[model samples]
Target chain A: MTITGKNKNKAVVESVAQIIFTVCASFAILAVASITLYMILSGTPAIFKVGLKEILFGTVWKPTAAEPKFGILYVILTSVVGTMLAILIGVPVGILTAVFLAEVADKRIARIVKPAVELLAGIPSVIYGLLGIYLLNPLMYKLELKIFAGSTTHQFTGGANLLSAVLVLAIMILPTVINISETSIRAVPPSIKAASLALGASHIQTIFRSILPAAKSGIVTAIVLGVGRAIGEAMAITLVSGSSVNAPLPFNSVRFLTTAIVSEMGYSQGTHRQMLFTIGLVLFVFIMLINIALTKILKKGAAEDGE
Target chain B: MGNDTLYQKRKRPGEAFLMAAIYGAASIAVLLLLGIIGYVFFKGFRVLNPAFLTTVTSSLKGTVGIAGNLLNTLYIIAITLLIATPIGVGGAIYLNEYAKPGKLVNLIEFTTETLSGIPSVIFGLFGMVFFGNVLGLGYSLLNGSLTLTLMVLPLIVRNTQEALRTVPDSYRSGALGMGATKWYMIRTILLPSAKPGILTGVILAVGRIVGESAALLFTAGSARILPKLGTNLVENLSRIGGKILQPGGTLTIELYLQMQNGEYEVAFGIGCVLLVIVLLINLLLKVITGNARKYGKQ
Candidate 1:
C-alpha cells in the first residue's frame, strides 16, 4: 500500500509530462494546419471575386485603378523565366564546383575553397541585395547604355532589371546546389570508381560516366531545391529587379511573384491586398509541386539504394 | 591499336576541357566570396565609427545609427528562442522516444517537413494577416516572436531529433531499469547527453531569426525605436511587458530600408555588422558541430 502511494505521485507527473510533450509534438501539425487553412481561406476570396483566368492570365496588374486589372501574367512570367535562367546558370557551376571539391581539387585547395562556400551560404539575402545595388547595377547600367546607345527609353534603373535579379538569384542558389551535390558525390561509394578504373576508364571518364550517373538523384534534388529558392526569394530580387510589373526582357525591370507581394504588401488594400494573398497561394502551389518532386526523387533514390 | 588510338584522341581534348571547367567553377566560387567580402569590408569598414554603432538615427540631430535595430535584433532572438526552445526540445523528445512507428508519427513527420519547406514570404503574409491583424497583436515584437517560433520550430526539432538519436538506447534502458520513470530518464540521461546538439539547434535558430527580414517586416512593423534602458532593473523589467507590444524593425530590415533609400554608406555599414555576426555564428557552429556545418535551406 505504501509502495503504491509512493508511485502514485510519480505516475501522475509522468502522465502530465507525456501529455505536455504530445501537445508540443503536435505543434508542427497545428502550424501546418493553420497555415494551410489561413492560406486557403485568405487566398481564394480574391480569385473567386476576380475570376481565376483574369487574375492568373491578365497581363496588367493595376489593382488600385478605377477599372483595376488584377492580371498577374507578367509577374508569373518573370518569376518563371528568372528562375529558369538562374537554374540554367547556377546548376552547372554548382555541380562542377561539387565535382572539383569531391574528386578533383588538391586537399589543401578544397579546404580553402570549402570555407568560402560556407561563408557565402551564411551571408544574408539582404546583403546580396545591397551588393546587387552597389556593384552589379552600376556595371549593368553601363552595359545597358553601351548596348542601347541612343535608345529612346528614358527610364534606366542603373542596372536594376531582370538580368540583375537573375544573376543575384543564380549566385544565391549556388551554395545550396554545391553543398547538396558535393555531399551526394562524396556519398557515391568509392567501389564504383574502382569498378570503372578496372574497366579501363580514365579518372575523368569514370567521374562523368559512372559516378555522376550514380548521384543523379541528388543533383536533381539540388536543382529542384535551387529552383525553389529562386522562386521564393524576395528581398534580394526586390532590391535588384526594380519592382516593376513588366515583360521579362533581360534589361527590363520586373517583379517576380515573391517581390510582387512584398513590393505591394505595405500599402495594398482591400482587393489589392487579397490579390497579394492570391499571389502567395500561387507560390504555395508552386512550392508544393517542388516539394512533391523532391520527395519523389528522394524516395526513388532510397528505393534504388534498397535494391 | 586503332581503337586505342581513337579513344586516346577523343578523350584528351574533352577531358582537358572538362577538367579546366571544373577548376574554373571552383575559382568562380572562391572569387565570388572574395569579391563580396572584399567589397563590403573595403567600403563599409571606412564608414564604421563608434557614433554610428552607438546612436539612433535622427534627422533633427543630424546623426545616423543602428542602435535601435541592433537592440531589436537582440530582443527578437531572445524572445523567439525563449518561446521556441522548450516546445521544440519537448517535441523532439516525444518524437524520438515516446512515439512509435505509426500513422500519427508519419503525419507529424510529414507536417514537420512541409512546414520547413514553406517560404518565409508566405509566413510573412500569414503573420501579417493572422497574427498582426486578426489576433490584434498589431505589429509588435511579441507578434514577430510568435511568427518566428513557427518558422523556426522545425529547425530545432530536426537538430534535437538528430542529437537525441545519437544518445544510446542503453542510456534510456539503463535509466528505466534503475526504477526511474520515462520522463525522469529523459531528463537525467538523454538530455544531458544531447546538450551540445540542442544548443547547436538553438544557436542555428538564432542565426535564422537574426537573418530573417521578410517574416518580421509585417509582423514586427518597421517602426524604429529603442526599448527602455534605465539604470533601475526593476523599472526596466516592469516596463518590458509594455514595450514588447511596440513595433520595431531588426538590423536586416533597417539595412533593407537603407538600400531602398539608396543610402549606400549606411547600408554597407549595416552589411559589415551583419557579416561579422554571421561569421561569428558560423565560427561557433563549426566548433559545436565539430565540422563545417553543411549548407542546406534554413
Candidate 2:
C-alpha cells in the first residue's frame, strides 16, 4: 500500500512538470500570435480611415498639412526599386565571390576570404550607415556637381540620394548572398564535376554548366534573402537616402517604406501614428511573403537532397 | 591520338577570363573589409582616450562622455539575459526533452523560425506601441529589455535545442537507471553537458543587445543622464534598481546621435569601441566552444 502511494505521487509530479514544460515551449507561438494580433489590431484602423486606394496608390504623403494626405505609393516604389537595384549589383559580385571560394581559390586564400565575409556579416547596420555618410556621400556629391553642373534643372543632387542608398545596400547584401551560394556550391556532388571533366569540359565550363545548374535552387534562395534584406533595411538607408519622399531618381532623395515609418514615429500622433502602424502592417506582410518563399525553397532543397 | 589530343588541349581565353573575374571579385570583397576596418581604426584611434570613455556629455565643458550609455548597455544586457536565459532554456528543454513529436512541437518550431525572420524595425514599432504606450513603461530601460527578450528568445531557444541534441542519449539513460527523476537527470547530466552551448547562446544574445539600436530607440528613450546614485551603498543599490524603469540611451544610440550632431570623431570612437567589443565576444565564444569540444571527447 505504501509503495503504491509513492509511485502515484511520483507520477503526479512528473505529469505536472511535463505540463509546465509544454507551456514554456509554447512561448514562441504565443509571441508570434500576439505580435501579429497586436499589429493587425493597431495597424488596420488607419487603413480604413485613410482608405486603401489613397493610402496605397495615391502619390502625396502630406501627413501634417492643413488637409492631411497619407499616400505610400512612392515609398513602396522606392523600396522596390532600391531593392531591385541592390540585387542587380550585389548578386553578380556575391555569386562571383562565392565561385572563387568554392571552385577556384587555393585553400589559404579561401580561409582568409571566408572569415572576412563572416566579419562583414557581423558588422552592425549602424556602422554601415556611418560609413555611408562618411565615405559614399561626399564622393557622390562631387559626382553630382560634375554631371549636373551645366544642366538647367535645379535639383538637390547631394551625395545622400537613391544612388547612395543603392550602393550601401548592395554592399550590405553581399555577405548573405555569398555565404549561402558558397555553401550550396560546396554541396554540389563531386561525381558531376568528374563526369564533366571526363567529357572534355574545362574546369570553368564544368562549374558553370554542371555545378551551378545543380545548385540553382540554393542560389535563387540566396538572391531572395538578399532582396529581403535590402527591402527591409532602414537605418543605413535612412542615413543615406536623405529621408525625403520623392521620386526614386539617381540624384533625388527618396524614402523607403521602412525609413518613412521610423523618420516620423517619434512626433506622430492620432491618425498619423495610426498610419505609421499601417505602414508597419505593410512591411510585416512583405516580410511574411519573403519568409514563406524562404521556407518553401528550403523545404524543396531538403526534399531534393533526400532524394 | 585521341588521348594525346585530349591531354594536349590548351586553356581557352574564356577560361582565363572567368578565372580572372573570379579572383577580382574575391579581391574586391577582401579589400572592402580591410578598408572599412582600417579606416575606422585610423580615424577613431586619434580621438579615443580615457576622457571619452569615462566622461558624460557636457556642452558647457565642451566635453563628451559615453559613461552613462556604457552603464545602460551593461544594465540592459544583464536584465535581458537574466529573463531570456531561463525562459529560453526552459522552452528548449521542453521541446527537446519533454515534448513528444507532434503538431504542437512542429508549430512551436515554425513559430520560432518566423519570429527570427521578422525585422528589427518591426520589433521597434511593436515595442514603441505595445511596450512604450500600452504597458506604460514609457521608453525605459526595462521596456527595452523586455522587447529585446522577445527578440533574442528565439536565438537562445534554437541554440539550446541544438546543444541539448548533442548530449548523448546514454547519459540520460544512465542517470535514470540510478533511480533519479527525469528532472534530476536533466539538471545534473543534460544541463552540465550542454553548458557550453547555453553559454554561447547567452553571449551571442549579449552581442545582439550591445549592437542593437532600433528597438531600443523607441522602448528606451535616449536620455543621456546617468542614474542618480546616492552617497551610501544601500541608497546606490536602490537607485540602480530604480534606473531600470527610467529612460536611458545605449552606446549604439549615442553613436547615432553623435553622427546626427556632426560629432564625427566621437561617433568613430564609439564605432571602434563597438568593433572591439564584438571581436572580444567572438573570441570568448570560440574559446568556450573549443573547451566544450574538448570536454565532449572525455
Candidate 3:
C-alpha cells in the first residue's frame, strides 16, 4: 500500500481507539455525576419542606408523631461525637500499632501482624455488625450498668449506645490508619533516623522526634482517611448504635447520620422517607468534604516525597 | 542495617513505657482479630450441619439453610464480574496506555478516586433510585450487579492501571517496531503480561461483592428464595437469564436479615462462611503477588 493510504488507515484506527477509550473513561464521570444529581434531586425536597434550618439544627426527630418534628440536631451530634471519639481512640492505637510494625517489631512479627490488619480491613461491615451485636453490645451494657449503678439521674441502656458505636467505629477504622501510618513511617528516610541517633538521641527518641515529624504529612493523611471511614460507616454502627434519635450521651441510644437514614429507611414514607434521602445528602456532602481534604493531604504528601 | 546498636541502650523509663505501649497496641490488634474469628467459628460451627448447607429455609419444616443465598451469591458474583471486567479493564488501558499525560487523564483519575471514596450506603441509595426506580429494574439481582459494577469499576481500573504501568515500555516499542498495530500489540503482549494483576483485581472485586450488604440491600431486595430455574433444559437456560432480572438475597444480605429476625445461629454461620471466604481471598492475593515478585526477580 502507498504511504499516504497507510497513514490514512492508521489515523482511522487511532481515532477509533481514542473514541473507545474516552467512552470507557466516561463511566467514572457518569457515576459521579449521576450519584450527585440523584442525591440532590431526591434529597432536596424534604429539606426544603421541613425548612433547612429546622431539619439541620432542630433537636427533635419524631418523624411519625401526630405532628412530626424533623430536627436532626441530635443525629448530627451523635455522628460527630461518634466520629470524634473513634478518631481519638483509633488514632492513638492505630499510630502505635503502625509504629510497632514499622519500627519496633522484628520482621517475622511484622509479617504476621501486617496481614492480620489487612484481613481486618477485608472483614465485611455486616460481620462487624454481627460481632458488635453479639459481643460488644452486651459488654457495653454491663459496663454501663456498673458505671451508672448508683446514679438514678443517668439513663439505663441495654448496651447498644453511642459508646458502643464509638468502640466499633474505632476498630473499623484501624486498618486505614495503621496501613497508611506504617507506610509513611517506613518511608521516612533512613538517613534522618541515622543522623538523629548519631546526635545521641536514643532509638525511641529518634523515632518519636525525627521519624514521626518527617512522616507528619503522611500521618495526617492517614488520620484524614480514618475520619472519612469512621464518619461514612453505617451497617456496623447501625447494629450497635441503639438506633434511637437522642442526644449523643455515652449511655444514650443515639442515631448517626448514616444509621439515622438506615434505621428508618426500611419502614419510612412520605416526608419521613424524603428526610432520609436528605440525611443521605448530608452524608454525601460530609464524604465529599473528607475526600477533598484527603486529596489535598495526599497531594502534599506525594509532593514532599518527590522533593 | 547496623542501627541495632542504637537500640541497645534503650533503658530509659519513658522509652520502656513507650516500647511497652507499642507492643501492647500490636498485641491488642492481633488478639482482637483472633477473638473475632474464634468467636464466629465457635458460634457457627455447631449449626453448620450438612443439612444446613443443602436445605431451603422453611418455617413449616423448622429447618434453616442458606442454599438459596449461596446460589444467589454465586450468580451475582458471576454477573457483576462479567459486566465490570471488560469496561473497567478498558478504562484502565485508556488511562495508563492510550491517554496522554494531560487534563483528561487527571479528570478521570480524580473522578475514580471520588467514586471509590463515596460510601457503599450512598451507592445503595443511588442504586435504589437510579437503577431500581429510574431504570425500572426494580430491586433485582441484575440491578444490584450493575450498581456493584460501578462500585468495583474503580478498583479494577486502579489495579489494572498499576499492572499496565508495570508492563515495561520495551514491549510496546518492540511490537510497534515489528509493524504491529497498537491494539494487536496490547492484546498479544501487554495483556498477557498483566494477567496476574487483572486476575488479582477481579478476585478483589469478588471479595468486595461477596462481602457487600449495604449496596445490595435495596437494589437486590431481600428475597431469600431461589430465582426460578426452569423444569426443563431449555427452561433452565432461560431461567438463568431470567434469574438475573429477579430479586434475591446473597449471603451478606441474608446475614443481616437473619440477625434482624433474631436467628443468631444462622447469622453466625453466614458470618463464618464470609470470614473464611475473605481469608481465602487474602491468601490468594498474597500468593499471586508473591509469585509475581518471584517471577519479576527471575
Candidate number of the best TM-score:
3
For candidate 3, write residues B50-159 as lDDT tens digits. 88878789889988898889888998999999989998898998887778888878778888999988888899999999998899999899999999999899899989
Evaluate candidate 1 and give its CAPRI docking class based on DockQ: medium
Q: Candidate 2: where is the Cα deviation over 4 Å?
A: A1-9, B1-4, B296-298
Query: What are the Cα lDDT values of the candidates?
Result: 0.90, 0.88, 0.89
Better of 1 and 3 by TM-score: 3
Task: Find the 10 residues in a row with the least total lDDT in model 2 chain B.
Answer: B2-11
Retained true contacts (fraction), each candidate = 0.74, 0.59, 0.66
Ranked by TM-score, top first: 3, 1, 2
lDDT of 3 by residue, A1-307 (tens): 9999998898898778777877898789888999999999999999789899999889999999999999998988888889999999999999999999999999998989999999999999999998898888899999998888899787676898999999999999999999999999999989999999999898899989999999999899889888888988888878788857889988898899988877788899899999999999999999999888888888887887788
Model 3, residue A289: C-alpha shift (Å): 0.5
lDDT for position B120 in model 3: 85
Cα lDDT over the full model 2: 0.88
| Each model's DockQ score | 0.73, 0.64, 0.69
List pairs with backbone clashes in candidate 1. none
Candidate 2 CAPRI level: medium
Q: Write the per-residue lDDT of candidate 2 for residues A186-291, one digit (tens) a residue.
A: 9999999999999978899998999999999899999988988888888777778886788888888888988887778878988999998898899899988998
Task: Kindly report the docking quality category of candidate 3.
Answer: medium
Cα RMSD (Å) per model?
A: 3.2, 2.2, 3.1
Model 3: residues with Cα > 4 Å off, grouped in runs = A1-13, A150-153, B1-11, B228-230
TM-score of chain B of 3: 0.94
